[model samples]
Target: MKTQNQITVTQIETIEQFESLREEWNALLFQCVEKDVFLTWEWQFAWWKNIGQWEYQLWILLFHEDEQLIGIAPLMMSQKRKFRFHFRWLENIGNPECDVSTIISIEPQKTISALLRYLQEKRQEWDGLELMEVNATTTGNQEILKTLEDSHYGFWRTKEEHFYIPLMGNTWEEYYNQLSKNMKHNLKRRMKRIAEMGTVSFKKYSGNSLTWQDFQTMCKVSEKSNFPDLYKSDNLLSFHKDLLEFMRELGWVQIEMLFIDERPIAFQYGFLFDNKYEDWRGGIDKEFETLAPGKLLMVFSLEERFKLGLRESDFLRGVYSYKTDWNPLSREFTNIQVYNTSNIKSKLAYWWVKHLKPIVESLLSKEKQKEQQNDSS
Candidate 1:
């Protein structure tokens, strides 16, 4: 056990250095107040391997005390061009693919405060910061923003909504009854029509029992669906294949498939981690659209999750009418951007592009339209 006071920060610059910290990194994950699989070492490393562009430099921050790992800020630095200027900025490693972002540690306030002080001291190193998919409600990521603001860090933020289902009641039927009358009727109708098509069955693959053939089945279903291009990309397929394999070893991967007459029509790719089941992605066959196989599978999947006594079933990102129809709870997340005001170049760039440029462009557009109207008169 480590005494909390003697904390030291180490910057991980190379992949080998990052790899060396894996054992302690994962151990810290379970000890954190918030359990997010996105912050896991495997997910972070996999994202870097498959999707991270070559130009970005790794700057993962590791916080330790007496040889025991306490916190991590899995970050990277890159330069971006915006409105005639290029500036360097830091951000969490997982982007575009990751939904929940935060400093992975037990005492978030203490960890973030120290990290901020470190950043403030080394302010010349970067131009700004942009962290996305921060669950402002849970994770206490607001602390990061607050700490920055208190230190006069120039930043902006925007929020988006994420939804989830909280399974209630001891029985699946009881939980089913809580849905709106319209939803209940729709589910009953879909189930009946699907049943009439042929023998209907649902299967779930988890752990090492999952195979590449199962992935191919899921891709085939996605290919035949409304989103035909969803699974068409080789890179995405490879990323998912690699991620699924990685997650399986940790016993966090789960895939659900609905078959009619032994033919796969709908499939769901999800993760069951730490008693929370996340309905990550799924696809449906267009030929079975009339039978509503997708909806049927979703209902079965939710029921299955409820039977397993999971704490919550998350719909993940993107708000849709169907997600709302399920009548689940919601969480709001924000994207935070912090400018390095201490650096003259970054300060000028931030103020010019983010503040002055937008207002100037809007006024200029309005004036141009006015001139045309006056000439017509």
Candidate 2:
């Protein structure tokens, strides 16, 4: 056992360097209290390979207590120009892609103290740090925030909504029964309609069962979905291809497809990690619109997870209002963009963003509303 002060920090800035930490990275994640699929080495690496590499450079910080890895910062850096000012900033990997990211540590306070000290020590390297999609509900993350506050790192946060269904030992039957009468009726009706078309079945791919062909088939279905443009970009498709290939190798890919006889209509792609099912992306064939394949598959997927002994179904972050129908509990993720307190310009920018910007926006919005009212008259 190593004391907190003895914990050593190292920086990993190259892909080759990152590849070496896979086993250790995941092992440390397994020991964390707030483990999620998004924080996995594969997910972060995949996101960086496809998205971050074009602009951002890796700045991952790893903390070790003599040879045993204890915590990971999972951060990256990019030189950015905004509002006509050039500056550098660091952020957690998997931005906009992962639902949330948090500090991976067994000891939150000790790890955060070490992390903050390191950041301040190297303040010249970055003018700010934007830690995105941090799960505010977890006590560990709360501790991280508190440590930053105590350290006097001037920080403010914005929030995003996350929704999930807590299955924590509840049977599918109980969950189904708990749905509102209208929802239950709609689900049954949709299921029955799809059943009438042909034999309804479910296909799941994970571990060794996943294949690129099967994954492409799902993408084809999404291409014709109500969210047709979701996979319209070759770049986005390429990212998923790389991400899925990496995640599948680790037995983390959890894909559930709803089929009618020989035809696939709806599919859900996500990771089943640490006993939770994250519903990353799912879509239905618009050809099956009348059958409501989207809703049918959603309920089926939930039940399938129940059978798999999964604990929660995270609907994740986005504007999917339909998730409310599942009676999912909700949480908020805090996105903190902290300035480098040592830099006067950075501190001023942070204060302006935290204070004056909102008021300015509010006034602009009111003027716009007044103009709209005059135009209507």
Candidate 3:
């Protein structure tokens, strides 16, 4: 273990170093009380194995206090062509399958300060650090951003609405009562109707007993039901397969399958890590839409998660109205993009796009409206 006085930041270049740092890194992250699956080694390593080759470089920043690991920042370096010079950027390595990205550790305040200091000193070697898709609502992230601001790093925010349903020690009756009257009525009606169809049941499976066929079936239902475009991409399919395999190996995969008369009608793919169950994906058999299998699946999944002793169940990133029936506390995530101040041309281009794109889109929308009106006349 290295003390703060003798702290060293080394680029993680070999698989051995990455594996060796895993225990310490995870220890620090869990100590912070963060509950996202993206921070898990199962998720990150699967991402690295599947997609890290696409990036220019990958680096893991480790901080130690008296020879004990205190914090870590898993980053990937990439180069993008700018107007003058090629700009290098460091970001939380992410892919389509992942939901959120940010620096993860227990002591974010201290770790972020050190990270900013290192980046400022090495500014000559690169353009700037770009922390993308951070959950701005998280207290630790707000502190990290404050540290960056104090260090003279320019940052901007783009808002994102994440959907979730909270479950802690509340009974199902209490949860349902909190919903709006109309929503409550609708949900109760849906569940009752589904129950009338046949024996409706929900089962959650994790651990090594789960089979690959179960995973493939869930993927197939997802593609056949909501957003076929997601599975259309070869990269996304490969990433999903690798992630499932990795999670299964680590016993982090939490699957909820809703059945009517023992026939699977809906399923949810969630990851149980860091004491939280993140609902990563869901699919329903359109044939069973009238039975409201989707809602049944979610309700059952929530109960199942609670039974497993999980703290929170996140619906991840969509704001569909149906999710509100569970009465979750809404939170906003943000996207932060930073550019090098030294590159004036790149700055100008970025400003133009940022400030002018909305106006251009609005004008085009009006023009289309006028054309539609003229054709009607």
Candidate 4:
């Protein structure tokens, strides 16, 4: 680590460098105020190896205090041409994929200052930054955003919310009884419908116990569910396969299947890490849609987690009545896009993201709506 001032900044730009920092990376993770399962080394490494490397360049940064690691910003940069405009921008490793993200730092101000100053100096390499899934509750990120606001080089967009249920050793029955009346009624009615069809059962595989066949079975059902986009691509499918293998060895993999009459009906897949269960992805068979097998699986999964005394149940990203019905708390995520003052390209890119693109998209959406109404009429 090279030191110019009190806080020294070093960057990890190679896969080999990332591979070597596994232990140190996780050790710093525990010190973060906004600790998240998605922010772990395993998740970032898996994403970078399988999907990100092909699309983005690694730009992960490390902030040090006289030889001791203080903070890390897991970032990547990508370039693209859209509508004849050539642009390059930086973003967090898990954009549109992983749910929650934040800098791994014990000293919020010191760490953030070093990182931003470093980025400010190297601004010529990238046009702008678009950080996603940053937890609003974390002070480290708040400091970073404050610095940006004061510097006049960045803008913070509208916040996005992610939901999680605080388990805290609560009994499953106690928690279930507290759900909204309508949710309880609906869940029970659907469950009864499922029970009438045949005997119901659930099977879970985790860590070394999870097999490729089990994951593929879940994938088959998920493809027919509401989230077909999650698996419709070969690259995305391969990404999950790779993630499954990497996570399984560390006892982080958690995939649970619900069955009726010995036929699989739903799959609830996620990770069990840091004593919290991250509910990442799930799907139910289209044939069992009428029975709402997904809700049943959610119920089973939550109950099982409570039984294990997990601290929290993260529903990940998205807002749905089904998740809301469980009475989970919402965590808002704020994103920022900052540009280099000296670079004209960076200013234009920032302007496009912060102003022009939204107006154009809104106009296009309204036009599409009008066309759809005409077709329907």
Candidate 5:
């Protein structure tokens, strides 16, 4: 009913504006081409409340025609300090924690062009745009990058390996049989060993089934594990606790724990969104490393995922030896840095980072290698 000229693009700058748009925002996400649990309103809002600082300015873009919300670019503006220079940059609100970051849009190309044009109008406010953790295999994201190039946006990309398991077959047993012989035997042997040691219990908590106490237990296990000490920070703990509560309300969260005689050894925190089970974060107490509790937990979780008929299980970021053991298909995630070529400072910084930094890194690497060689001699 609305013409192209009737469509309006508005910038949401305050949390109040963001909250009021939640229903419509989620509705827009439901129809988006790229669907992930991280893109939800709950996740975005929670991230802003917990991880996001007051210094960062919110720059969420919303597009609507005939009062019907169509697209959203969930972004924020922040200052990046490098070598005594503070450069303003635009980035997605949830990063480092949220994987597969992307805009929520059915028409990605059109929406991206409009958002970019809007950004250009306010070019003075930011020196660059760093779109990180983009799933490289996604056609929509590829088109967005191409559009940026066609529009003469000065940008460069770096990639890292991302992995996921594509579920197949009518039953879990069928899928299990497809694994390599060594993996199959090892898993069975380890599980059997665990059973012999003590009563092994694998419990999965979903939705209302999970409680704050259960979450705390998982956190305790993570504290004892070899994973990065994210829980040690009160801010991160608060963020996750809040995030878990929000996701639980949506029936989107799942927590898996491996218990040996009621003592938790390993824990996996994940989400079920759009029929896919995504592995968010996990930890295994190294004290039980010889028992291979982490691997046992994963095996139990995979079997549960199969029973649930989930489409796939994404291990998210990082390429670990255990992930390779699962034989997951990989999708590369790219970090895109777009500079405002019109700005002198932005141009200089981009050149230094894109050109000079790599050369310096290579030289340093060679020197380190030589040092090691000389030490051995």
Candidate 6:
């Protein structure tokens, strides 16, 4: 490896460059002390191939020293509207199932300064820079934000609360006992009621081990449980299939199926990454709502995570009351927009959107209400 001061930044220009650097990129990414699966090449490439579809341009920046790869920032530029200037954004290309998306690398101490310098030098080429949906708890984010602030990049707030649960300890029983008495009682009561009806069982399988029938059943059940209309979208189904296959290849896929008397009732699809298990998707048979199969599946999955010696259980992006009952702390995230002063019009538009947009919307809403009242009278 080369010394820190000898590092060079190169923009990945083609798919060939990306492919050539895949192994080294992933190695450095995984070496980070608190890296998440979202930063994995499998996840990133899958997003580019499956979802990006030439609509966006990728501008990955690599930091290398003496022929040793150390850092990367996966960035994309996309046009929102004709009148609105294009924005350059950086993220992990995370799905709803993943948490904490941003520009991350193995050695922040060495690479962060180089990254900021590069962005600062290229400020005139891009309208703005956005790092969206970053997990506030991670030091990677704190360091990056501080560097950007010191570099005089524009900053704005987006969101303040994200929820996740911890899965620490040796056994499920011990972990469950940590919950409030009321939560424990409720979970037990639900399990007992479901058990009284028929023999209930749970199975965890991976994409490689799972048959095609298993995937079909999960899709069907999820469609029936969540949104039937959404299930019919061909792109969505294809995306799910690709995600499952990719996760399975990385040995991170986990499919938990719940059954009653040998009939499938509920199922969950999640991933195990960086010593943490994320509950990404799930579906339950609405007909079995009385049995609370969804709750049973979650309880079983939590236990299984503990059995595997994982450190955390993330419910992903959503905020639901049921998740809080498990005693996990909620974290806040930010959506940042940074721009250069050289692009005056673009900068003005961004400022209007960030600061004055809410006030404009509120006033418009009030005007609409008064007009409606006058017409009615």
List the candidates ranked by lDDT, beginning with the highest: 2, 5, 4, 1, 6, 3
lDDT tens readout by residue for model 2, 1-377: 23358988898989889878889998899888889888988888877877778878899988887776789999988887766778798888877677878889988887888888788778887888888888888889999987776677678788888899988779999999999999888888888877878999988888878988888889889888878778767667777888778877778887789899988999999888878888888888888887778788887788888888888988988647689888889988888887887877787888889898999999999999999999999
Q: Over the stretch 241-337, how does candidate 1's per-residue lDDT look in tens digits?
A: 8788788877788889999888999998878887888887888899888777777898889888888898889888788986888787899888888
Answer with 1 or 6, whichever has the higher lDDT: 1
Candidate 3: regions farther than 4 A off: 1-6, 81-86, 192-198, 229-246, 306-309, 353-377
Q: Is candidate 5 or candidate 6 better by TM-score?
A: 5
Give TM per candidate: 0.88, 0.91, 0.83, 0.89, 0.93, 0.85
- For each candidate, the alpha-carbon lDDT, in order, equals 0.81, 0.84, 0.71, 0.82, 0.83, 0.72
| lDDT assessment of candidate 1 | 0.81
RMSD of each: 4.4, 2.8, 3.7, 3.0, 2.4, 4.1
Error of 1 at 111 (Å): 1.8
- TM-score for candidate 5, please give it: 0.93
Displacement of the residue 178 alpha carbon in candidate 3, Å:
2.6
lDDT of 3 by residue, 237-344 (tens): 676677777678677887788887877888888777767787877888888777567877776776666666676777777778667667788778876665555556
Better of 2 and 6 by lDDT: 2
Off by over 4 Å in 5: 1-7, 372-377
Pairs in clash, predicted candidate 4 = none
Candidate 6 collision pairs: none
Residue 272's lDDT within candidate 2 is 85
Report how far residue 267 has shifted in candidate 6, in Å: 1.8
At residue 306, what lDDT does model 5 achieve?
84
lDDT winner: 2
Model 4 segments beyond 4 Å from truth? 1-4, 232-234, 352-377
